[model samples]
Target: MERKRDYMTVQELTENEKYKFWYFKIKECKESGLSVKDFCDKNNIKPSTYYNYQQKIRNILC
Candidate 1:
């Protein structure tokens, strides 16, 4: 029999963890040299989520 897998909710991640997660994602996007949509499509990440986080991080920095 196969067992189920558990996943943590976004609420469970600390603010710093969330920052690091998005930071890496943005860095990966830059290094990949692919358009945001293309990179997100290849990684199976929601493009909206990527854009939202990018804006959030910018806001935090400013």
Candidate 2:
């Protein structure tokens, strides 16, 4: 069986596009007020990745 890849690297996405994509996703996830684990599970994102994305967004915002 062929496995589906979950995501792309920075080089694969334009800077603004990457920021916008995760910005909305993280915004929506946080708005739900779900635990990180539950949110990741619901959104099909890995815990570490969710965290990394959060940090990345924070860095971008600040």
Candidate 3:
């Protein structure tokens, strides 16, 4: 059986795609009842990098 991927490296995505990707990830993390560090660890993302993307998303919205 083939497994599907739920994540992609930011470099493989276009600029807008990257934003949306991280935005959804942040949202998913928030709704998963997991702390940011735990979520990042489970997802293979660095906590600092996740926080940076979260800040970037917020800056875009604000």
Best candidate, TM-score: 3
Better of 1 and 2 by lDDT: 1
Taking the tens digit of each residue's C-alpha lDDT, what string does model 2 give over 1-62? 97877986677568778778888888888899998899889989998987898899899789
**The 10-residue segment with the lowest total lDDT in model 2:** 7-16
* Residue lDDT tens for model 3, 1-62: 97887976577567779889999999999999999989999999999999999999999999
Candidate 1 — worst ten consecutive residues by lDDT sum? 4-13
For residue 4, model 2's alpha carbon misses the true position, in angstroms, by 39
| lDDT (tens digit, per residue) of candidate 1 on 1-62 | 97765965567567779888998899899999999999999999999999999998888889
Compared to the true structure, candidate 2 yields what TM-score?
Answer: 0.70
Between prediction 1 and prediction 3, the one with superior TM-score is 3
Rank the candidate models, highest lDDT first: 3, 1, 2
- Segments in model 2 whose C-alpha atoms lie over 4 Å from true places: 1-13
Clash totals, every prediction: 0, 0, 0
Reference-based lDDT, each prediction:
0.90, 0.85, 0.93
Candidate 3, RMSD to the unseen true structure? 11.2
* Residue 44, model 2, lDDT: 91
Flag the better candidate by TM-score, 2 or 3. 3
For all predicted structures, in order, the TM-scores are 0.73, 0.70, 0.77
Among all candidates shown, the one with the greatest lDDT: 3
